[model samples]
Each structure stands twice: as C-alpha cells, then as structure tokens.
Target: MSALARTAARLLLGSAMVGAGVLHLTTQRQEFRAQVPEWFPVDEDLTVLSSGVAEIALGAAFVALPGRKRLIGGLLAAFFVVIFPGNVAQYLESTDAFGLDSDRKRLVRLFFQPLLVLWALYGGGWLRRHPTG
Candidate 1:
C-alpha cells in the first residue's frame, strides 16, 4: 500500500481505538459496576478508569509513533495480553459486561480480541506493508 493508504488505515484504526477508549472512560463507573462481578480484584472505578487510560495511551502511541511503531505495537500487544483475563473474566462471571448477551456470544469476542492484538503487532512499517486498504 502507498504511504497515504497506510496513514489512512492507521488513522482509521487509531481513531476508532481512541474513541473506544474515551467511550469506556466515560461509561466506566455505571457500566462496570453493573456488569463486573463482585469478586474481581480491582474496584469498579479503578478497573474502568485504568483500562480506558491504557487504551487511550496505546491508541495515541500507535498514531503518533508510527516511525517507532514496532516499540509501540509491541506495547499494544502486551496490553492486549494483559487485558485478556478481563475478557475471560467477563465470560467466566457470565456477565454481559460489554453488552454481550451471554457467555456463548462473548466467546466470539474472544477470538476477535486476539486477532486485533495480532493486527496491531504485525501491521506494517518494519517490512513491506500489507494490503490494509
């Protein structure tokens, strides 16, 4: 893909991430408290706020540090790994935390989550760009 295309793809994905992060931050308390299990390690406010902050940071890094995308992407990969448990937790607790109807439905998200992580990690800049467009 051309540089313009790469930039466009990056921008679209990055902006979406930022928007998602902001959305999470804004809705964290009410949503998390209602959905997350009482047994979770972190408090509701903390959980929502921290994850939102992390996502925003990750999103910004992906956009602003494209030249250093490897390092930033690696960070995002690690972030995804760190957050996988929450995904698992959501299902294990049988909670529609992110608005999923049931554990079975949430399983679909599990598959996509890992793929998103991989996309961030394996996305271009180091080698030849993929046909992201």
Candidate 2:
C-alpha cells in the first residue's frame, strides 16, 4: 500500500486501540474478562486493567509519535500476537465474549487475530520497509 494508506491505517488502528483500551477499563471489563485463560495466574480484572493501560499507551504512541512509528508499530504488532492465546482459550473453552456465543462464531473470531497482527505491521510500515530501512 501507499504511504498515505499506511498513515490512514495506522491512525485508524491507533483510534481503535484507544477505544478498546477505554472499553477494557470501563464497560467491557467483564466481557474481556471472559477471554482470560484459566491458567493465567493473575486476577482476571487486573489482567484486563493492565492490558487496557498498555493498549492506551501503545495507541497514543501510534498516533502521536510519527517519528517512532516503526518502533511503535512493531510493539503493537507484538502485542496483538502476544494476546492471541487468550483468544484461543476463549474459543477452546467455549467461553462467550464479544457476542461470539457459538462455536462457529468463536472459531471465525480466531482468524481475526492474525489479521490484527498483519494490520499492525502493515499500518506501521513494518511490512514494507527493512528494520533499518
């Protein structure tokens, strides 16, 4: 994609991360909690809150720190990848969250995780440019 498109995608992704972080700390806390893996040792609420803060910080960086877009984008992409297991747990455990109540719905949701990873990479221009490019 063009540089302009990358910028737009980055901005949109940043906005979305901000929104999701807000939800994590606010109304969607319980919904997010449902995705927490059973084996996770921390309190579900704490995990949600911490991740929310991370999302907000990363999101802000993505939007406000154009000079550091590559670094921020890399971090954001890593973040998406890191949290993927929670999504898998939700699907495997059949835990309903985000309206993904049925098996098919939950299964489909799993595919979106990779898309998020790619989106972050592409939006951040990480996919196009070399790390030192």
Candidate 3:
C-alpha cells in the first residue's frame, strides 16, 4: 500500500484505540471486565483499567509520534497478542461480553486478532522493504 494509505490506517487505528481505551475506563468497564481471564491473577478491574491506560498511551503515541511509528506499532501489535489469551478464555469458558454471546461469535472474534496485528505492522510501515514517510 501507499504511504498515504498506511498513514491513514495508522491514524484510524490510533483513533480506534483511543476510543476503546475510553470505553475500557468508562461506560464499558464492566463489559471489558468480562474479557479478563479467571486464571489471570490480576484483579479484573485493575487489568481493565491498566490496559485502558496502555491503549490510550500507545494509541496517542502512535498518532502523535510519527518518528516512532515503527516502535509504537510493534508495541500495539504485542498488546493485541498479549490480550488474545483473554479472548480465548472467553471463548473456551463460554463467558460472554461485548455481544459475543454465542460460541460462534466468540470463535469468530478470535480470527480478527491477527488482522489487528497485521494492521499495526502495515500501518507502521513494517511491511515495506523501503518504507516512505
């Protein structure tokens, strides 16, 4: 994709992350709590809150620090990977949240995680052999 497209993607993803982070800390906090795995030792509320903060920081950095896009994008992708197990637990444990009420919905949701990773990488110009700003 062109640099313009990559930039657009990066901006959109950053905006989305910011929005999601806000949700995690605000109205959707309870809903986000459902994503925390029972096996995970951290308090659900704390996890949600911390992740929310992380999302906001990373997203803001991704958008405001173009010079560090590559690093920020990688971190964002790692964040997605890190949260993936929670998604899996939700599916396997039949825990429902965020409208993923059914097994099929939860299962299908898992497939999108990789796309998020790819989006981060591509938007950060990792996919380009010669990335152009």
Checking candidate 3 for backbone clashes, the offending pairs are none
TM-score of each: 0.78, 0.95, 0.96
In the order shown, the candidates' Cα RMSDs to the true structure are 4.2, 2.4, 2.4
Worst 10 residues of 3 by lDDT: 123-132
Off by over 4 Å in 1: 1-6, 32-38, 124-133
Ranking by TM-score: 3, 2, 1
Top candidate on lDDT is 3
Give lDDT per model, in order: 0.71, 0.92, 0.95
User: Which of 1 and 3 is the better model by lDDT?
Assistant: 3
Q: Model 2: per-residue lDDT, tens digit, 1-133?
A: 6899999999999999999999999999999998899999999999999999999999989999988888989999999999999988888899988899998999998899999988888888888955473
Global CA lDDT of candidate 2, please?
0.92
The clash tally of candidate 3 reads 0
Tens-digit per-residue lDDT, 55-124, candidate 1: 8887887888778777776777777788777777777777776578787887888888877676666653
lDDT of 1 at 15: 70
